[model samples]
Target: MIHKAGRASRAAFRQADDEAFGAQQNGSMSKSMPTAVEAITGQNWQSIFVPKVNCCEVAHADRAAVLVDGANYFSHLEATLRRARHSIFIVGWDFDGRIRLRADQPADISPPLGALLRGLVEDRPELHVYILVWSVSVIHGPSATAPALLGSPWQDHPRIHMKLDTRHPLYAAHHQKIVCIDGRVAFSGGIDLTVRRWDRNSHRADDGERVDLDGTIYPPVHDIQMIVDAEAAAVLCRMAAERWSDATGEKPSSTAGKNDDIWPRQLPVQFRDVSVAIARTSPAYGGRAEISEIGTLTLDMIAAARTSIYIEAQYMTAPAVGDALAARLREPDGPEIMVVMTHTSKGLIERFAMASNRDRLIRRLAKADGHDRLRVVYPVVPSPQGQTQVLVHAKLIIIDDTLLRVGSANLNNRSIALDTECDLAIEARNEADRAAIAEIRNRLLAEHLDCAEADMAETIATEGGLIAAVDRLNVKMRGLRPFSAMRSPGPTRPIFGTSIFDPVRPFRLSLPFVSRGRSGAWRAPEKEL
Candidate 1:
């Protein structure tokens, strides 16, 4: 039943896989990897964004911007929500109604997210708001889940509907973070509208405003959210509505006639008149075909990179991704790779499972980096207490100056094939678009290095590449630090070593002790340590 385009896409992927295999067997990628001459001459420049293979569709976006941190994303989200005249749909792994979208402002002026939504619905008769959060999040998420499970004043209104999404397989989470306003604009990325998530771009170690519901100050965290308008936004809006309908069995009213300009005036647009591709990762369930568009897109982008590949992720234990990066590293003239991740996972369970696997993958990648073109580090900021590592929660990737992707899917097995995820990607088609994408990458590197964007760009030019520039600029009190393998202690290691906590596919109670891997092999999941 596959169409011509699908067959062509499959053929392209098969060719890539065959080339990679040949390179591995030959111990050199001179025949497979693109040469510097070809890259510079712009010869055989085929985009990796193939619809039905790496993405759902490529839609036109009138305007788009990458919100670097939580501060920018939350502020813009609040503004856009207030301007929603017809419909507002939000989907997230976690959503705390008690958290203030704009904590910098007074409570009276900028109320909590729940209170703000309540007020908006009360003021506008035609306006309706729909929120969907993962069902299991009520148990594993923050304290705000109690209010959502029980009755709350904010969701008491009929116009404001909140539902817990239980449409996925057991142990599979709905991990997408998306917000669409009146079908005019949409926000999608890693930032969740929850507590302990908001922090300024400065990432001061001791920000007074970065606190939880109980007023406990949390460590600084960094995340990204990409905002898009026009047809792209409408596509996301439809996706969000479809998710709601699947979970709640009620299709929300369409926003056909409610075309209010909801783009936040304060937010700056990074790109205009661009093609935005929507990638997703959804587990197969209820007769639905599994979608691994994000995973496929990530591999294709890595393969297509000519100069550099920049990544910021919360976790780095996806086996296929590690193998792909390792293969690239073995290339004598491969693109330089820079990865920014958290110093350590937050909870004990995560630390035991994710950290061990992360170190193992890092060691593997390090071993394969024969030409030393890889740099894996975590960001830190100077506080009054001393230097503290900033919790990097952003899921972002930049392939040279050609492509930019931001989404909720972490570099983990669960995100690739098990959990539901969404990512927004844009490919540069012109010089202006390329410049904008490169500037955004520079801005992110500057934020991590605690240097000016212009300085980062200059350093990259002077040092020849991003890896060299990072090496030069990372000698500061607040900057990136390399990771080292650390042994996990205790017998709980073995319990968590299994993919029981982070399966690559849907969980079946009948086969509770086994899980299906990407290769369609049934094995007892165990993390290599």
Candidate 2:
């Protein structure tokens, strides 16, 4: 029997669905084909990605840049931190103080991240640094560096306030990764300020610099970080403060002054004067209502695609997203879909749960692709020894060169409904914005193919589509390979594996086994086991 609260949720979702479908029907009836420039720039963006109610406010940024890999991101972050005059706030899933910031400097010249921050605080009397990390233990096997050191020296410095967030529901985590400096500039995306994340754009199969605190080498890792300034930076600072308050029960007032320019001088601006949308996902916990704007935005973007949908994520298992994609694929002239992901997951539970679900969704989408418009591949670069597949941990989506999104949320159930996530979406508002968005996508493709950006752009123009361009450029040396599905859980899936561990719906076992209702009514959730 459907519980009262479950019924209410279903009803609310049905209402949302009706509204979206109604809007789409109205949009379809319009007999107007916009010009290329108009379509790419101001193409009904407000209708496509509406702001989540009470989740995030629309903000403006004077400048924005997309840092492709951790190497560039960390270097720019270190530079910004070095020049931070008032305050610094970092919010992420994991953070390690031992990770070295400067790869080119000697040990004496370049200190560890912890030492660097400590020295900064000591040098600047007014500088106050705040770090908030998820309170969870993880064993990254030999692939990643040291285990996250969330204790001691991280909080030993009086000026550096460190907090392990435990305010989330059971098994749910605060997964938003953000960094703000002096309330003027902010960075957000999938990357955490941790070890084993530093790597050059080349993504060499065997790089000496990709080492742990103990000098142990790891595989190539890729991620994206979006930088923003002006009101966008202020919005991120406010998010940090809200999370800090939620975790520590202390409302930390912002020390950031408006109009302070903290954007790095060395970084190139990818887009100037762009409006950024900060979408979030936070489960209802500690008396707060759940926020799923990021999830909504993901689905809306997928539905809004007209030509192509390009995505790079760690995992793909959200049912709502999969259903939306399947519907789009069934359309006769639907957008071509291209997804880039890790060949396989690393953790045992993730492999069993996420991969199992991913394969299921892939099969579903494949069945819906009657026109053969779907392509899924993983990037692999060949070195002197053997083929090394670069791990695709980037959470990014590009829709028809008109919309670009980057964030910490994975294409997974947890990211949609459980963990806290933050994403920045930029709608192309002019020819420059469209060019920047396309350049970012082409640059990513070039990096994977180990080809020049100009060549990549030329090939894409020649081939007329990204998939065909990728197919033509893909060679044995360094190129994207079709993802081979790993062994799936098969027809009789075990409930204890996914349902209990990587649950689609975040549940609080310690609570009174009740779901909050709009009318203050409570009811038991549907039985999962």
Total clashing pairs for each candidate? 0, 0
Question: What range of 10 consecutive residues in model 1 has the weakest lDDT sum?
Answer: 486-495
lDDT of 1 by residue, 71-178 (tens): 889999998888888899999999888899887788998899899999999998999899999998898876465687895888999899999998888778899999
Clashing pairs in 1: none
- Candidate 2 segments exceeding 4 Å error: 1-47, 53-55, 138-150, 153-155, 258-260, 486-497, 508-529
Against the reference, the lDDT scores of all candidates come to 0.81, 0.75
Worst 10 residues of 2 by lDDT: 29-38
